[model samples]
Target: MASKRPQSPPISLVELRKRCRDASLSEQELTDYFLPDEENSKPFAPALKLNEALVDVGRARPGPDAISKLYADATRAQTPLPKKPRVLTQTFRRAAKTKLLAEGDSWFNLPDYIYPKTAIDFLGSDNDFDVSNIALWGDELEAMVRAKQYRQPLRSGLFGHFLFSGGGNDVLGSIPAYVKPRKSGDTDPAHAADYVKATFPQKISQMMGFYRSLANDARDATAGRVVLYVHGYANAIPKKGGHYLGGPFETLGFDPVAHAPLCRAIVAQMVKLFNDALQSFAQSTAHVVYNDLRPAMTERDWYRDEIHPNESGARKIARIFAESVRANTPGV
Candidate 1:
């Protein structure tokens, strides 16, 4: 007989430890065992969250040696910026270029999708930006702000460019909660704005507050040297096949196929609200720059599912960020 597959929760602590030590265990298997799918849970479980099973197994955190090994690749082979013009002061002649750091949702964290690619990965390859990314899959904007995983990396003014990709997961996750029901006599909304509930603006406002606070923290931590690069998602046409949100839509009586127009309208509204808030916030905040990704990705760029861009789409988005880097920073 074959050994039974390990289950998620409800498994014995002994089993959890055994699996953790098992070199053959794949990342997905470990993730599922540690962070099981819960009903109505957020699309992606917090990848970095501590689990009790591991705690009981005596592995509280990555040991220092492990941590060092993990980040070695990212820290190595960084290209230093060229010296400033001779006209500049001798003290500031050859200050190192600001390091790049990234934090946020799956857009920055998803590396194991069908094609082993992500926007951040593309940015590194296409733009030669050496970024130490701490983004986690399924992380919402509020969660990312509260997590503060970037704090340690942002210190010492080492990281000058803080690339962020958030708000998309937050808005997508909240769609079922705030989307208004289609009225009996309603026609397909002419504008995307018409599809959302009256409270959606307030919801967006609250999310903006999270973004603002996060930006402030990043800036303050680096003593205003770090320039934040915030990006918003493209207007993706809604469809039936995503990891999350599909069931909620059907439950609300909106079929992605039959109600394509309405679904797209809602997605548009969400995207607009998120992007507008980010752009406005960047305009007001010092050292904060917004990269509008709406034009970079089209339906063709996305995977078969409603959310997530394919490899080509990821490359296109990375090109936009490369432009932003060139415009803002020098000697890359």
Candidate 2:
């Protein structure tokens, strides 16, 4: 008889490592995982030391689940802004027959006032549509799937649509490391385009793989009746290396004045690269639709920062998403 293949790990060690990097794990949990049980066995000494150091600095807390719970609570608190009067609303309304499930990063988790209507809000607004959003801030494409953030919601029931917003955080988080110092009078667009062409292939392939896996999972869970909607980001113009909500990216070591133009270039290039990948993915996959919100978003003054959208901006993107769904899905 042939030997059985090695069993896979029950939980994603990668996700666990990501949690540790984010400081989402408690001191005790880190100690239990990294340290030897009886002091005789080998331990991950560096991680133990780091854990101890974090505790000393009051960064490590008591409960292992506390930080994760806090994150979930924060995400849940992002309620939709009260519906504006007819004059303020610009998007067409269509009642939906299907439930909506959303997963991604801060684009979906940031408060409605700040990031505005997530795609789910648009799909669920007019119909008896139940919505479940499991998006978390700072989430990357692979991390969300590896952690099963999308899977948990699928268990609730059969959803008619799965709206995904990701890949932006992954690019934004990595690009600064790759951006080169600009030569005097170097055009921002050219430099940005070059950086994207050089870096996007590998990242795009990785993102495509994650999306493929997600598509497979959704098909299994929903019997191929669910529609997957992937979106592209709008161009962002950052005046400085700081987030809109608060927090400075100055610690990342870029000169705010010298690098600001390059940052804008990167944002524009990132949107194009992501949208291109999304369009290609949609072409290859069944029931996957790519919604290009960039055109509508670019013309409006909806951005909160370089990457996130304000409430008005969110409404515009949501409107586009809703219209796309109404047009694409049969019997919706």
Candidate 3:
């Protein structure tokens, strides 16, 4: 009989990191073995409490059923009574103070740290302004709108300022195709521009629809008192390519050394396209402000990986956003 094959021991986190650095294991393999299936696959939640809150409200749908039963009972009664005049009294109270509501993807989600602190610290350490974040990891613009997540907090009419960060994932999702290797001697710029021209219109329209709906909802809920702020992404080094996180680009299944330049160029163009679209949308929409963080972010050592910013970077973004809010909103 053949001897039984020896089973390999489980890989520790340390071993995993070492293998990732050595390029001995792919990110997908690591994720499959170490991470929960849901974590690896499900889209991130908008807010910690959003799902629970939705469930709580969902249970209240039976309220109308009770009202219908009451109507049925009233119809069975045959007696009539004289009606009494109703007294009316009016009580007035101050309007609730406005708060900031943030929504978007991982940039605002900040997996490793307390994200709201970045914005809250800049707004005021004393907590003068309330801030709520509903960002999720791996969220696309269309998904958020389709889920109706944007309308949830706005429905309360309590938010006075809106902070949004998105479109990064949309671009990232298309990166593999966007940076696909072309034939030898093909002009990179022309090829990239052609891709952008063909793909960006439909993408931009989808993004615009999200913005328009958000703007219209804010106006309806807050009577146009809410201010919307959107920021552009900073440039990143393509050579790194998610190395810190053991991301797909770590292996890339291609010649990384040869393709690095084209990848970088494609990233730059993608950022520009998204930012230009955001600027144009902001220009056309009322009460919308676009902050071009590219110049500052490009200079700052803020990125933790190819896609995410470290604490320092987050703080800088918060400061810029806070300044914009303070300037536009009358009494900060």
Off by over 4 Å in 2: 1-68, 74-97, 111-124, 155-157, 243-263, 299-303
Best candidate according to lDDT: 1
The digit string of per-residue lDDT tens for model 3 on 216-239 reads 877776788788888767665454
Give Cα-based local distance difference scores for all models: 0.65, 0.58, 0.54
Predicted candidate 2 versus true structure: per-residue lDDT over 1-332, tens digit per residue: 99975432332444544664565654344433332112221110001122332233243343423433333333343332222223323344444244577777766664332234554555557564555666655567777777765664564455667888887765544455444444556555557766454556677778888988988888777777788888877776554534521112244334446666665666667767778888998999998999887777653544444456666777777777777767766655
Worst 10-residue lDDT window, candidate 1: 69-78
Model 1 lDDT per residue over 154-216, tens place:
874567788888777567666677776665545475754665777878887988898889888
Cα RMSD to the true fold for all candidates: 7.8, 14.8, 16.0
For model 1, the stretches where C-alpha displacement exceeds 4 angstroms are: 1-41, 44-98, 111-116, 185-187, 241-245
For model 3, the run of ten residues with the poorest summed lDDT: 45-54
Highest TM-score: give the candidate number. Answer: 1
- Write down the TM-score for model 2: 0.65
What alpha-carbon RMSD in Å does predicted model 1 have with respect to the real structure? 7.8
User: Considering only N, C-alpha and C atoms within 3 Å, which residue pairs clash in candidate 2?
Assistant: none
* Clashing pairs for predicted structure model 1, backbone only: none
